[model samples]
Target: MNCPLISLKAGAVIFTVLWTAWMMWWSGAYSTANLVILAVCGAAVGYVWYRAMRWQFERMGMLPHKDDRSAQ
Candidate 1:
């Protein structure tokens, strides 16, 4: 639902899918291995983002934005 880790994972998956598709369409050098690498990188970014946001929210005593779902 509204879990930071889950949101991060979903964001990573979405980023990987979009990036993989873009690479396949625009770059002839793209490969399955490269896609996998990008996906991994995306996952890492998402994880870092999630952790940072969680820390910020906890420190601030607030969610990112209670009324702004788009921020997440």
Candidate 2:
């Protein structure tokens, strides 16, 4: 199977942005402190999610091998 076109960095960024936006909208009352906390938490969650998915995909051979220089 072809590897997914999205890179880890891109996936994390996309996830974080979407997550933060969704949370902000859901909360309905925004504050500077809330925005900052949401952004930071979103990024951290996104990174962790990316790593977990990457590991699973690699194990399943759905992602490029780490040592494959031409994979990227």
Candidate 3:
């Protein structure tokens, strides 16, 4: 498991979510209620993005785990 790589990915996702939410709020010109919805959706997107990256990295043999050695 590469801790640095994982942290980098997480940081990127967080940055993306923050930037996206701000852009949505600034550009959508929506009401407070709608902005709340956007925030929720942005969170979901970030979670999915993070999971997808983790899955991809695992598949690519980039993510390591102590148990993985026993499996092989």
Candidate 4:
């Protein structure tokens, strides 16, 4: 149950990081600045998605309950 969701999340995180790196290199020029910028942007999006998914799951009672809002 939860394992599938956890696995999906893990897959998404790794996929985002790897895809960002690959896309950076695949586009040619190989600029460090470009890679860094894109990586940071990708990371931010991934984090937002992760948080949103977790929040929804928590609301649905699919995840353990906790007062995580104050931490944010």
State which candidate has the highest lDDT. 2
Query: How well is each residue in 2-67 modelled by candidate 3, as lDDT tens digits?
Result: 585669577767866796678686876787877777777777777777777767776777775447
| Model 4 spans with C-alpha error above 4 angstroms | 1-9, 18-29, 67-72
Query: What ranges in model 1 sit over 4 Å off?
Result: 1-29, 63-72
- lDDT by residue (4-69, candidate 1, tens digit) is 656655765676566656755666656778767766765676567666766677567665555565
Cα shift from native, residue 8, model 2 (Å):
2.7
- Lowest-lDDT window of 10 residues in candidate 4? 63-72
lDDT (CA) per prediction: 0.64, 0.82, 0.72, 0.75
Q: Lowest summed-lDDT stretch of 10 residues in model 1?
A: 61-70
Models 1 onward score TM values of 0.50, 0.75, 0.65, 0.60
RMSD of 2: 3.8
Evaluated at residue 63, the lDDT of candidate 3 is 76
For candidate 2, the 10 contiguous residues with the lowest summed lDDT are: 1-10
- In model 4, pairs of residues that clash are none
Candidate number that wins on lDDT, 1 or 4 = 4
After superposing candidate 3, which stretches have Cα over 4 Å from the reference?
1-9, 12-16, 22-27, 65-72
- The TM-score of predicted model 3 comes to 0.65
